[model samples]
Target: MNIKLIVLFFSLYCLFFVASILFPIDFNWYNSLHKPSYTPSGKTIGIIWAFLYSFISLSVCIVVSMVESFKKAKWFFILFIINYIFNQLFSFFQFEQKNILLATIDCGFVSVTAILLAITAYKHSKTSFILLIPYSLWSIFATYLNYNIYLLNI
Candidate 1:
């Protein structure tokens, strides 16, 4: 693996963490909300996100290193950008704005985009696709969780 590419992928992954910090979940506010019984604690959430980000970074590194064509690479990069946007949007809605409805919608978009990104990565590298499956699954679960919260609180 190219060290520079790995660094680049990891750097991009770190931006997601930065976004989370910029729009952090207010634990007091969150606790006050009517959350689902299935909701995990903040510590659990942090650990899961750490694993997910590591997997996502690895997948991105594989896809970037294995892409055979510029066209395929372009599509992969575009999908990644879109997915990141939705990811940040989810945080902005859920934590910063406290808009559960918008957050649920954003989570839905994140899930869909994650699946699409996995599919796109699959074309270039199976390892990349496989690595991304957990993140995609987590995104889907998060979408459901967010939607449930919206329904319950409404």
Candidate 2:
């Protein structure tokens, strides 16, 4: 495996990482909201996202390494890019903009794109697909949580 390619792929994921920092959660506003009893603590959510991002970075690296040509990885690439955009925007919508409804809608897009990216990566590398499974599941769960938050807040 090419270590440089792996680094490059992982670097691509930094966009969302940077966004999360830029749009750091506002605990004051967040704590004010009516959240579900099962809503995870901020620290728990942070830990989960850290793992998810690592998996996503590793999965993209695997797919990039296994594919013979860029064409083979194009769909996976496109889907992941879309997923990243939606993922990053969630912080902007939820924390920066403070719009739970928009955040909830963005979560749906993030979940759909994550699932599609995982499925698209399967043919190239099963390991990569497996790595993305948690990401897909997490995104879906996040969507559910966001939807509930929106409902409770409204």
Candidate 3:
């Protein structure tokens, strides 16, 4: 039962990760954007995202299992789900159609999610907070990237 639950949650996380990859399938996607030379490559982004998702899944699983306060993880779970979906959807606003404004707005939401998750994790499970540090940092970076893209395109 426990193993199945773990598998289920991990599977869901991977589904979003894979969706992100395909959702940005247009090679022209990169070509359209005037990116910083320091911007990560597709392969680098893929690997980092995959690794981050794995950590997020494991940390959430641990928190859900160990935390006694259903109220705590419950709200955090909702926010986390919203954040994950928004993260995936940003690709649509960005690559498929190239709406830099919408993409920047989406990144704003992602930034909020990161802070909310960080606070919730810190309150509910100290160890979980560590797991999300990378996520928080990435959100900050992504916000800057999105802003730069919007400025460069428009």
Q: How many angstroms is residue 105 displaced in model 1 relative to the true structure, after the best TM-score fit?
A: 0.1
lDDT of 2 by residue, 23-50 (tens): 9889899999998999999999989988
**What are the lDDT scores of the predictions, listed in order?**
0.87, 0.89, 0.78
lDDT of 1 by residue, 36-61 (tens): 88998889888998988888888888
For candidate 2, what is the TM-score? 0.94
lDDT of 1: 0.87
Q: After superposition, how far is residue 72 of candidate 2 from its true place, in Å?
A: 1.4
Where is model 2 more than 4 Å wrong at Cα? none
Model 1 stretches with alpha carbons more than 4 Å out: none
Candidate 3 lDDT over residue span 1-154, tens digit each: 5986578667867776655667756776676668777788888877887777776776687678776776757878888888887888788877776778888899889888977887887867788889888988888888898788778777
| Ten contiguous residues with the weakest lDDT in model 1 | 63-72
Which scores better on TM-score, 2 or 3? 2
> How high is each candidate's TM-score?
0.94, 0.94, 0.87
Q: Arrange candidates, best lDDT first.
A: 2, 1, 3
What TM-score, to 2 decimals, does candidate 3 have? 0.87
